[model samples]
Target: MEKIIKEAIYIQSPTYIGSYKEEDCIFLLKDISHLVTEKDDKEREEDINDGVHYSQMLPFEDTPSDEYMNIFYESLKENAMKVAVNTLRICEQILKNKGNDVILVSLARGGTPVGVLAKRYIKYKYNIDCPHYSLSIIRDKGLDENALIYIINKHKSTNIQFIDAWTGKGVVNHTLEKACREFNMKYEVDIDSGLAVLSDVGRCAKIYGTREDFLIPSACLNSTGSGLISRTFLDDKIISKHDFHGAKYYSNWKDIDCSNYFVDYISELFEKIDTKSGDKYTDINIKTAREDLIDIQKRFGVDSIRKIKAGIGETTRVLLRKIPYKILVSDINNPNVKYVLLLAKDRGIPIEIYKDMNYLCCALVTFAE
Candidate 1:
């Protein structure tokens, strides 16, 4: 296991076609799905509250159908330029604040796409070849300490910024903050947990591209759009101390990999954006995600806030990653959510129309064991 873990990463490797530039950062992950250790949707509710780490439960993976993928791509193609500009604008301020010290450590696999785009935009606009490292961070497991050690060993800067695609009830956001504090207290290294995301509907991030819960094409697919990597995984049996968390590199999916295309499509749009007036999103939906999530937890009787996922991106994740009891979509017919509807239907999951909700949709985890 140690041999495989060490050989899996390419810290000195250059950016290549099959793998990503993330080769510079340590990737302490490898595919362990063959263990067949994953659980179904019915096991989600009982095991979630058991307080075991979510990844340890191993939710079954279901790849979205071709129709579902096409909708997501079309949505991204239409809005790529605009979204790219907004992302660049948000990342610009972050880059300025961090200066020559910008070390973007995106929480893989969701944040990998955003991190790459930010890296590409910086190269496009400021001529800075910023280094982006995609690492694993499970909410309950905390940020990967070994990964941080690997980065510090290379860069030695506390100016690391965590990035994610969006905030869903801000659980991961909150988890990051807590993880940073714990890491600092344990190792005396200062790491900020304020994540940079493209969408911050939960208003948990100070550095965000937008607060709208829209369809992010990246959020639509599992790993095909995320560097052909599998969702991150961790377990004591497969992962040992002094090792980074694990994830599978889906090398076989290279033909369909949209990771590079997604970034380039957005990078081309950075030139068109007028950074002077890109403040188009809502001014921080500033209510605490904790409070909002409490209400959601009560309403859904999900028993735990972690089981109740809010926002369009997160709801899509629930359907994709876990067994969702029902999806609360404001409009199943909205083209933005068309893929979501298909995903739910494909899984035989129920969809409900809740027009007055704050987000595009919310997915409640099955309460039954």
Candidate 2:
């Protein structure tokens, strides 16, 4: 399947729906906000379980409440330095390994903010203005081929590095590797699938800032935190072969959108923290994390590993989007999961104290019948 590389349909902040600056990152996604209808969360979850590809539909996102917003701000204030330090570490590693001319292709939504922060850090520290683009990569549908082709045509494939905020069950990591292989075969270009993340709670990625399952405030909100952009959507009915994967821009949410605030707050701390010291990647027991996940699946009777979302970020996502069966927390008093507790309580979802769990918290998605 030979694909003719065409100029990628890309957009920057303000011009599109995102609040990011023009230089922060380019979004390689077509805005299909007007073309697709939103589905109720529960209905969407049930449809996904019935073998409907999740990327085909967008879930309706509600405006977060004042209380929830408070939690997000509190979490950010408490963990700003932690996130800043990790971002620096990841950026430094990128320069050391991939060199100065690396192109950052952050997986859309979650990775957008992290990519923007990394790009800012590289310029601030090394004075290198590396190009950054946010593209969509659905789990089953694979990387947006058109987006990949567009980027490959513009930048050196070898210099491309994928970035994401954190790893959940490492599903995306495996998905990314598989997609890259198929894409390379089709396009005859080698794009490395190595994902650089701020938090590697799943202990999956080769490059990560920390293995601690702490709260990344970005996970606290939906599209509002991610440039008011809906999760990347792809439907054959709406998306064409020549079109990039689709996403809806939450234009109405601009007033309350925290996308820019999240990045700006963390980026501001870059100069204050000493990136040289205490910036070592602590080795985590990947085997143990994997074993723990398997044990969790068995104990919870979850048939699919995808249903068991581990780590603070993953758990937050389950609470925000999926029909959660229950939430497990290692410690109830830990400030890292304050937002989790709030969400669970608000939803009236059962919360269990799993003292021996590997992650600080984990969310079990209900098997929608």
Each model's TM-score, in the order given? 0.83, 0.91
lDDT of each: 0.71, 0.82
lDDT of 1 by residue, 85-134 (tens): 66876687788677855888888888888888887777777787777888
What's the number of clashes in each of the models? 3, 0
Residues 37-138 of candidate 2 have per-residue lDDT tens digits of 899867886887788888889988889877658868988999899999988878888888899878898998899999999999899888999998888988
> What local lDDT score does residue 80 receive in model 2, on the 0 to 100 scale?
91
Worst 10 residues of 1 by lDDT: 1-10
- How well does candidate 2 match the true structure in TM-score terms? 0.91
Candidate 1 RMSD to the correct structure: 5.4
Worst 10 residues of 2 by lDDT: 6-15
- Which RMSD does model 2 reach against the true structure? 3.4
Instruction: Mark the regions of model 1 whose C-alpha exceeds 4 Å error after superposition.
Output: 1-18, 22-52, 62-64, 284-287, 320-323, 330-335, 338-356, 367-369
Per-candidate RMSD vs. true structure? 5.4, 3.4
